[model samples]
Target: MTSKIAVLGAGSWGSVLASVLDENGHDVRLWSYNKEQVDLFNSTHTNPHYIKDHTFSKTLVAYNDLAEAIDGAEYILFVVPTQVTRSVAKQVAEILEKNNQKVDLIHASKGIEEGTYMRLSEVLAEEIKPANRNSISVISGPSHAEDAIRKDITLVTVASRNLGDAERVQHLFMNSYFRVYTSDDVIGVEIGAALKNIIAIGAGALNGLGYKDNAKAALMTRGLAEISRLGTSFGANPLTFIGLSGVGDIIVTGTSTNSRNWRAGNELGQGKSLDEVIDNMGMVIEGIATTKAAYELSKKRGVDMPITSAIYHVLYDNADIKETINQLMTREGRSELS
Candidate 1:
């Protein structure tokens, strides 16, 4: 039941997951590109830069060198931002090649690559050699680090093409507070994980504009339609959208202040420039980049995603938020199921 796990990325979510594994009696090695962060976590057993007022498990170790962190690990978890996923995966592949070790891959990060429009799993698959990889799995849902660290009842789905691989991850992170479900719909899970951030941005913008629950409710409902539209177009199960990674993720990220994508949208709706919001947040607002990727992807796939398009224009074209909302409101009516 005990395994050596290398968690690459020392951000808020990564640290929290590493702590969870450590508490589960696993040997967890957390790697951060920033040596200071690794040193800080090792010395104080905390990551104040991201998650404050919380102490990490003492058994969890921090490493600056990727090779050292994954030296003997059986599972490698990628929790870095989407933009850096490919680069980090390349490094991981090289290390795995030199060691001639193959490990199951699990990524908690979500986003579609802007130019390639590939899902994070796809990006990892491309970078990590097939010989050095066992199975690629993704853990996604409504769970957030802020809530998970408090031992809240958090639920997520671990999905992969291989059912056995998913079950393996399910047992790895499941606990009293953290519940994990298994799914074979890797495409649906990853799409839902990546696209929900776009809807969350719209939800935050509505809140910033002083919209009521009725309006927020409408936005979320229609946003689900857009997510499902594109997801199913790419061969995802429609039922997957109603599950944890889809509607569950939307409700949590879209309505809550804890989501960086929502917070970024709130600032944007309040008349702050995208640059200002991004600079102030000092974190990766995935929806901003994801909006662009999804927009292009929807166009290429001939899928209608007005919400994603509106957010893309606002973030990239500097469109007026209020006007954009009005435009969305005035769009021609269609059947609810359409």
Candidate 2:
């Protein structure tokens, strides 16, 4: 079955998804804010700035205009940065209202809003009118664009309050190399997806500091504990923290050089300033912003996310990384399960 899908955002993941959908025989319009990128994609079938050397399906089209990209689309997927999600949703709402159209909302972006701490789906719900949307869903897991583009065996979970909607998306993306699973733990999946980036940054920092596997292993384990603690506080299923979006995501993002968040933390650990790292990466390092939001959320929810707080201090307070590590190592001991 052929469907019209609009994928918003032109970053690495977004472009890869657009290409995947195109290969799935859907009419896909990829929207990018940059006109130059749109033109380049349309002309060359490649996103040189992000996914260099990877060719997209020729059937995939790129649009600079948001409304045009979404026109008559049945599925609207948001892959933009979390901070810009609300603004883009606002524009999408206006366009949908004007066109008297309704579409299912899906987001692949991962982060909590810095001030509101709302998840991406929550931000979409607040902006897009209920009348203008059918169902809201999220896609998340350990899959990375750099791997997926090579037709790597990638698996992800598509979750929605509505199981049928999740199944629908599962069919849309599943292929020989891409496998999709359905889950109903929206809160757990989304929380795991957003918070894992923070842990990944810590993992990269460990690598940058020449920490051994023992330290990396400890960081990842404790980081999952922090993720689960915070996630369960928000009514997420504890079991979901062990699923693909949770432990799997942390392992991949936290350890991989392909991860922008990990790379950013690596640079920071090597003594680069946050500004320097950001300017050099030329991509949104989600963990940096996510650390701030999660830090605030932990305080509001009174969750003991020591690692998140440590990363927050290093990134925001100019605290010495070594001192922060010492503080974490010296903290009073408690039950591991606590």
Candidate 3:
């Protein structure tokens, strides 16, 4: 039986995933807060906001109302920006209460919020009822929306407290071009997704600085270690950091031009101020916020994350890239072990 899938965000990733599910023969309701996006998807069969080039199928229905989008849906996909995730989940919880419907939640967003530093699923669990917590799953990995929309082969991980719930979503989203693996470590997956963006921004800075592959390689390896340190500090399995969501995701986001974090870093590398880069890009770069949150989390948990700290200082404290590099290189050394 086909599942009724509802995607909450209309950005590139959301639209791309909705398109994949539609092609796989599921009934997908793609929701958006904007009226123009709804009209384009429903009328012209194209998403002018994100994936403007791809043609959406008739199975993809665009909804402007949250209740209508969630009504009778078997599964909900949360794809909103990290900053708005909590608010949107609260709104969804209210609608579910009003309509008396219960469904599984699949989150694909990555980034920690400013104040809470909570992962996306944590924010959802807090906003929703206790009973709804069991149905939440996180879908994350190296999947980039730009390539996915073009039907390029991509791999990602689906994680949840319940393996069955994660596998259910794995089957729902897997297509000819997209593959999904399962992980019991949702916390690790979320950490990997959130932290990789900051590293990507750092990578972009290196690229902007005209550094070669040697610099990128060192940054990627050292950054992965720091991300794993933070994840382990939070009780996530350390091994999950080596899986698809960790090193795999870090490499994709840090290297790809399609990554918003990497692009933001690139602009910063080119000597543009943070405000200038944000204004020019005109999209939410998850790294900027995640850097700040991860920095705080690392300090609170006593985890050693020199790379994240450097990126944080560079972006937030107005520290120079050259000086940040010197600081990281001069940090106290420690033994490497599990």
Better of 1 and 3 by TM-score: 1
Question: Could you give the C-alpha RMSD of every candidate to the true structure, in order shown?
Answer: 0.7, 0.7, 1.4
Q: What is candidate 2's lDDT per residue for 65-174, written digit by digit as tens?
A: 99999999999999999999999999999999999999999999999999999999999999999999999999999989999999999999999998999999999999
Instruction: Evaluate all candidate structures by whole-model CA lDDT and list the values in order.
Output: 0.93, 0.94, 0.88
In model 2, the worst 10-residue window by lDDT is 52-61
**Candidate 2 accuracy as lDDT:** 0.94
Which window of ten consecutive residues has the lowest lDDT sum in model 3?
329-338
TM-score to native of every candidate shown: 0.99, 0.99, 0.97
Q: Sorted by lDDT, highest first, which candidate order results?
A: 2, 1, 3
Off by over 4 Å in 1: none
Among residues 3 or more apart in sequence or in different chains, the pairs in candidate 2 whose N, CA or C atoms overlap within 3 Å are 200-254
Task: Choose the strongest candidate by lDDT.
Answer: 2
Whichever of 1 and 3 has more lDDT, that candidate is 1
**Between which residue pairs do clashes occur in model 1?**
none
- Residue-level lDDT of model 3, residues 30-71, one tens digit each, is 999998879878998887656757787877888999888888
Model 1: per-residue Cα lDDT over 1-338, one tens digit each: 89999999999889999989999999999999999888888999989978979988778899999999999889999999999999999999999999999999999998998899999999999999899989999999998889999999999999999999999999999899999999999999999999999999999998888888998888888999999999999899999999999999999999898899999888887888999999999888988889999999999999999989999999999899899989998999988887
